[model samples]
Target: MMFEYMDKMVMFQDTPEGLTADMGWLKEAGENGWELVSSVPLIAPNRDGIAYGTVGCQMILKRPKPTQ
Candidate 1:
């Protein structure tokens, strides 16, 4: 069996509206047959080289490879 993978980064402003948008993106991916495998928080660094907080998430998805 073969598989294909995709990595999607969804960003947000740490607000309710941002969360809604992110959820929409994930929903769209699911509708396209992409299965969620893992999710990792994405953090942004400050200008002083310090990790502030999570600004988004990195979603890893996989699906069966299509054969031609």
Candidate 2:
């Protein structure tokens, strides 16, 4: 079940302060059992000065326990 859901899942990348998402999508994802795993921030220096990037959260969800 988890694998099936994950296969149909989609990933999104958003630039820092570039675009925003509506609350409805977040709520729907949560309701469908999507869990947040991690989030990261990216930074880079451009000709202007500095630029910021956002690596949105990641989620690893499984039905059966993951084996090590």
Against the reference, the lDDT scores of all candidates come to: 0.83, 0.45
Model 1: CA > 4 A from native: 16-21
Which pairs in model 1 have colliding backbones?
Answer: none
Tens-place lDDT digits, model 1, residues 1-68: 79899998877664655553347777787888899999999888999989998888888999888987
Model 2 clashing residue pairs (backbone): none
RMSD of 2: 7.0
Instruction: Tell me the deviation in Å of residue 24 in model 2.
Output: 3.7
- Report the C-alpha displacement of residue 19, candidate 1, in angstroms: 5.7
Root-mean-square deviation per candidate: 2.3, 7.0
TM-score (C-alpha, index-matched) for candidate 1: 0.76
